[model samples]
Target: MVQLSLPLKWVALAVYFGTMSTSVLAFPQYQSLAGLSERELKEALPKLTPRLPTPPPRPEVYQGAKLVDDAAHPWRAPRAGDQRGPCPGLNTLANHGYLPRDGVASPAQIIAASMAGFNMDLQGASIATYVGHLLDGNLVTDLVSIGGKTPKTGPDPPGNGLVSGIRTHGTFEGDASITRGDDYFGDNFNFNQQLFDQLKDYMNRYGNGYYNLTVAREIRYQRIKQSIATNPTFELVGHRHFTAFGEAVFSTNMWVDGRVKGPLENHVTQEAAEAFFKNMRYPRGFFRASKPGSATNDQLQFVLGTDSSRPGHFPGKNVNGTNSFTIDHSQGSVADFCAFYTYFVGTRIKNLYPNPTGVLRRNLIINIEYFYGSRPPGIECTKVYPYGQL
Candidate 1:
């Protein structure tokens, strides 16, 4: 509301007029500097085009289902303590010469014996694939009985342990990458060495000095560490252990043809079979596909031979034999779930954990392993090995 003198008003008017004149000349001057005429300037500007988002590519589908072997492949020599002999579970079978007596109980030997029993061809197959089939396809049972005590109490609560400190038996195939950093397991819980020692003992006693379950377990654990360093999504939480602490995995069986004349025929029910695997636990190990072009890496699959060809599948011996195997908790003394947890899931990580700081992490891992073990098998077992007495 202040009044200004006439001279000041005239000065203000001159400034306003100068500014307008400059703005009007600005575009023309810019055009001149750019060496473009008005028409050219308009034409030089880029045309606006509507952009559309691109659709994501579909996931790769694996198709190789045929099993093949490579005759040129050389057999790997067994490590020390791989000599085969008698074990607690199958002394009767070994004494009878049903299973081979010379080979070590290592992964390769186990594959050879299992393939021979199943009538699968493994002449040229990669020994790795053979191990995968034997581990994934077979059902391990403990003929030992638990003295009226449950080994496991319940699923591990989240934030308490990685995957709830529980484990399942079988292989889960997927594109495992190291970049993921095994963060899928949440807290980092190193596998316990003491548990491995116990596993070694299991090998000496049950494996007859031929197979060292602990060594095999450690090898797989190392492989997983390497895999995590290389792959992006794959991370190992824990592995399946046959001997939950000192308790035996009891009765180990494979999915044989239900029609095959064997001692395991007509023993398992669909309900019980489903229930057992619903909470199945497995030890850690590296597995590869015998056949290529398939989802042979991460997804879990459980299989067995059944009595009849259920539907469209071929009428071969039931891969899911009705009574392929049983864990006669009633036979010998079996350990309870708590002991099983201690050895399989808890011990490996718990014992090796950095006390206090890793305690929660170890618990978390145990929980997660248990969670997966309680679920049905999702990955199908592929035949990639041959059968031979070990």
Candidate 2:
């Protein structure tokens, strides 16, 4: 759907010499604040921050477990032409008609649908949606295929890789996925029964039948070990390092019956988990979280942590051969968003965009701020501006 492309409003300032880079940049109507005049950006110092995209208004109170996939939003199996992906969360959204069932969606549609359908927090939804859009979406069309590369997403942006959907390895999706295989194994999006079995096993052993923080960490640690032992190209660096934990938290929390408890309560039964992960359907009468929620920096630390003595605790790569990983202490961990942001924009984005100007450059500036500003409270990370100011 070409829904979010609003016409850019051009304005002239006599004092400013340079023309406003003829960048025909576009964002959702709610995000008009992010696309500022360079002069305005310069004038407004630390205050010129991107506002979180707010979803449609809702009832004040928590409406416990109702039919989320009701008559209005029914679940349907994906047809042959439909796209599905590594993230079961988005897949479920599409399956339930919260997103376009065809699998192509704009960042705004994704953000709104995700929040309205699941009560996802603005920060959490914005970060995930824009990351997918910026890295894997077609900026010209403002479309992202939730699954594999498809012409339905429209042509690739001039030189920014293939614009090959979220399933592209190491972009937004990466290794140690609880229910999916690494791209090295050939199919990264398809559900991996073997890995799911391991996940269930961890819940049985650690969480006593619930997927809590303890089960989350144990399963996460075990999965990394499995990948290191088996896969030839096992790399957990950059965004994957933190996103790995965020995904774990999503699984551990997303499908739970909200009537039971709180914002980030960890009590997802295997049945609820199985329903979402495998069937792409909610457990009947499912209610979303009492409040919008997701993992915080402290929560992420607890979920990603393991015994320091373990073999695969630190990030590394196999320079010599399989299993011959050299510890990459320089890559840093989820605890440090500053380093992650710096590395992500400075190195990662720069590779995709060797020299971005015009609309692309301005969009990059907006997206990264969405990422860092959402960092959990008490996480003292100074923002990194790789694209220079506005």
Candidate 3:
């Protein structure tokens, strides 16, 4: 090669040395271009380490009374031994001398005596009309229709009798006849007469006059007791003694819708009645707000009539001067008029809101009445029963 200039030779030497030094420092065998250790390289590299997701928040805890879970209902199979008979409210009534003091008093006798204490008889004419409707064949026909079976002339098996239909009616309607009827029978008389006429017609069409009065009465008594024993209100009654507070709400002359008659026909609207019944749960804020020493205003227990009647607020239907069977307000002397009353009261009290604190709230009683043949406008009946009234 030709001889190189001085600067060119120096440049060639410098390039050769730079390349050698870079190779020695780079640590190529370790896959490190920066001459770093494994730990240093890892630290210098952009880290993509895996991580767990953040957890969600917890649910708020209720501080007031404990709720009765689905399994705690008294009527559920294998009922607790303490769950028999009327709730503790009945016993409390006996203890306070409002009812019979005899230890041997049956629930039926106690209920009868309680009705008598109000100057009302279970066999009064109003009650009798309701009883007649129950015994009438129309109720059975309605049940048979609902069951998709033809009405048979004779009774079938014991459990498959006309009572089965009544039970279905109670279940399908959420036992609303107990409370909503108060508005109808307590206020509307013409509607009540219309209901009675319909019942008579139903009886004439389907009644065979074969059902025994004594048997029917006993069945009614048992059914009423069972309804009371299994109600959520009855459970609340067990937790608190209401009589100590000297409070009670007596709702009179309630009625149910006639068979084949509902809201569409301007009779007790089936939809309205069902909606009212479905909403019979314990009042809102009852648990969290009803603790003893708390200033919460609670509801009073209800005693209402359970007779069938025409719709209280009928729309697009003419019910004036109609012969619908309403609570027989005419039968003033005999308790027959009052029989339906007892049933209604019994069922209503059976459905009180559950007591979260296992104690009754005090100073709350709401009596829904026609007072002057009409409910006072804008007044709402409280849903909670006083702790002690069963």
Candidate 4:
């Protein structure tokens, strides 16, 4: 082996050092890994509005109004003479008697120690659906009599036992319309008498006995009678009333409102129900329509329609993934409820929440026929005059 001298070894080491330095200098520039660009956000967000704090989720109990329970709603079959006594929904509260049977309430126990229950449901439904329920459930069935086996007939033939054919449209021009009658059963006062009787029944069942029940009943009847005389028939068909007991199905399609060629006020005519269903093609899948000015995820929906062929239609998709059609109580009209509640409580809510200038003040009413039908079991408008087919 040839021995390398110390001087050569030193030179070789220097050469090695130079190669390492040169290799390091040839490395690529220090670039960062890909990242979100500042411009990306600027281009993405269109505009920023001051986010208003969402109103606290509806309270469990506002005054005496009860919050609607999703689970309990479908089970709330109306308990008229068929079932008799207080409804299961009300029975839940009555079992304890609106307040605790055992202990003190009010200052010490303001909140219900038990489940907060109202004689009528207050918060669960949309203003429209509730109104529909009120008209179909309360006014036509409970309020009116139309006594005798001589079935209430129109120009059209009466078909099946299923609830069908609502007189949603048409003016209250003649004696035939519910507007003219005072009682639902019997020829006497027509719907008017039935209305009084039902009011009496509500007082007996739900009233706290704050005032003379009979006198109060007379006062309430007068208000309804006057309302029918003054306003359009639709006004009598209060929106909240329909939603309360009527078979309602709502869709989440935000565009549904915008699709209207005319203003929304005009759009909610008698034909509106038919028009809305006609347009949607009866969507079956889970769809979401946001309430106006809500966040993207704040989607809403309702059942498409009810099968009046039976008292309870099979629950279906409500634009949301949840089953849509659900009803346990006979729909009660907000107008009637308002009248009833006010008579009991001794004042109206509108008196408390008055509207200011330019803004319209709304007195809640039921769009009864809109939900199911204004007619009896055999001849409901829902049966003959359906949304799309009609």
Candidate 5:
């Protein structure tokens, strides 16, 4: 277990597993949905936690390769009302109707689509969806725009509150993206051809015509270096440190056709990369990954390996001058898995809904639990309930 700076108190217990074995000291067991609440706090909260949406079933038979962009699922440009964002995977799914063409989807819909379209494992997709939805989405309606903020995600809160959708920078979307530019340099949602070209350059030199973990590590650092030199507000602290690398690894892992397996497991080719990054189209007869996959800790290690140059926990923002970074790992660091969790739930989520109550509060806690269970590489930390149990 992670030795959090503070001791684990009695407000809430770690609730990741399905069943609890034995408890020690004041700590208690939080099992399933039924155990989350004493009584339905509101009609919205059937239990203290909402039931997670079941992912779409994988086909029983693997017929050569199942075409995700098949006749039934045709690629179409997003209409004016439909949303698109930094996540090209979601955008491609929407283009082919794997998800709703409108781009506004519930956590359940998102989990289902990610599974069916990209074969992203339910755990991986849940980790992404809950964090994205809770922070940038509408908790009341359980809807989030895959692109820029839209009124479709229900009414807004008073004051500085923002239901800004997935495009809201500093939440899940952050700097050093594989295909998108930093939000500090303006429009971060749409594909930036310049940034993508840089990715191709690194891929040519590193992967020799393919996008893999090696290329991802180099390109990720290069992109960050670009941001630090160009954008004065470049910051890679907190969850952004994780995303900085995770996003690139995700592209390499998920973008390549799962049909091309064995020796070429995680290799994404040029023709295929262009289809996803530049055009948001699946290559001809594109098939979902042979199985569910995501940027797990093992995959992410490629980015945070023993390379002395790579910033592990020493992620920081440019102080003032170009390339003048002031390293700070105060909140957390990518090198420490539990430290990442401490920063994510304790800092980010806590700050977002400090005074949440009723349905709003209940959902936040449940979603936080989902994030806790996402389990990055060496996550052994106890869940932090920033807002103590009411």
Candidate 6:
């Protein structure tokens, strides 16, 4: 080799030393820097960018349980053309004379017919005890004191007291002493007795003994209907529909019962009642307790009827206004006589039936009349002049 200048020699020494230092630090535990060639040193040294650590075999992302759709689940919306009108069951009953073919009947008439069919009695001796036990034992004492007059009782009894000599028929005709009956009576008597006991205990313990008279009447009829309306062939007469109605009625009664010791007392507001009614559901063709808050794809579209908001009406007044009635009533004084009868007769066709495809079926008309009132007046007749007009 030729002799090199001093500066060039120094530069070559520095380069050699720097390369050696890098190799020595690259892997301290393994080979020496002096043992490796330049190419080998370059291969052995650590990368400045660190080779990204081989990316740690990317972990898989976890997904939750997959959803599965089923028949009962995901509440399918109602379909188009699913809504219907008044049930056809009413016509069937009319043809059989179980109800009037004219489609006109009063609540009293309906009550009478149902009573006759079932052999129930409202005026029987047990009624006083039953009614008294519903509100208070004192009520029985008061009734007996006043010669069979319904006692002015409740959280706030009516000023006029009960219409004298009027009593409500229970669902069963059994003697209170009897424990059971042959068919529905066995269960029904127990059910009614339990209901009475529960109501009495509730009123005595938690409520003010004041019953909501109008609501009580409604409950009585509802209970009666529930007990009697169980003919499989009869559309309106089914356990399911009656059960639903009874539930609604019971709920309302409980609501009123709660108010007995609270702020509202027997004065359940119409707004409140309507709200409760709006939320009620029943079998097909029966009334929906309330207007549906929302619409679904399969919801039936039908008119309930005109909302009658008369201020001075009997039940309406009791619920919305200051007027209150005692448990007693002369038969003709109750305004809902026609409305109730018509509702029972008209809504008979809404019984639940099997669908061929097993899909949800729609009721024809919304049975709002039970909660509100009936339309077209259940019965209307004009006097005719046989000879000359008077």
Best candidate (score: lDDT): 5
Q: Give candidate 4 misplaced runs (Cα > 4 Å).
A: 1-87, 97-183, 186-236, 239-242, 245-301, 304-390
What lDDT would each prediction earn against the true structure?
Answer: 0.25, 0.67, 0.23, 0.24, 0.69, 0.25
Query: Residue by residue across 242-361, what tens digits does model 2's lDDT show?
Result: 678788887654577767765436688988889887788778878876667667666677876756766446666556656776667565656556677667667766666555555556
Across 210-251, the per-residue lDDT of candidate 5 in tens digits comes to 999989888877887778788887888866786667777787
Model 3, span 322-387: residue lDDT tens: 322122222121112133233332343223222211111111111111111111223333333333
Give the per-residue lDDT of model 4 (tens digit) for 1-390.
887799998899999887766543321111100121334223212221212111112334333322322233322222331111111122222223342221111210211222233212222322222222222111211111111112223211122211211112211111122112322222321224443344345334433321122323333334333433433321222222322122111211221232234334111222222222222111122111212211011111122122334312221111222222233223223323333322211222223222211101111122212223222123222122111121
Which digits, one per residue and each the tens of the lDDT, describe model 6 over residues 1-390? Answer: 789799999999999887776643433111111123345434433321211111111111221111111221222222332211111121122222333433223223322322222122222112222222211111111111111123333311222332221111121111111111212233311223454444444334433443333333333333333333331111112212222222322333222322134555433333333222222111222221121111111110111112223211112112222233122222111233333333322332222111101011111111112212221224442322111121
The whole-model C-alpha lDDT of candidate 4 against the native structure comes to: 0.24
Off by over 4 Å in 1: 1-74, 78-335, 342-348, 356-390
The top-ranked prediction according to TM-score is: 5
Q: After aligning candidate 2 to the native by TM-score, how far in Å is the CA of 4 from where it should be? A: 48
How many times do residue backbones clash in model 3? 40
What lDDT does model 6 reach? 0.25
Please tell me which model should have the higher lDDT, number 3 or number 4.
4
6 in model 4: Cα distance from truth in Å? Answer: 99
Candidate 2 lDDT (Cα, 0 to 1): 0.67
Evaluated against the true structure, the overall lDDT of model 5 is 0.69
- Higher-TM-score candidate among 4 and 5? 5
Query: Which stretches of candidate 5 lie above 4 Å from their native place?
Result: 1-65, 150-163, 311-313
* True-structure RMSD, every candidate: 27.7, 11.1, 32.0, 30.8, 15.0, 36.0
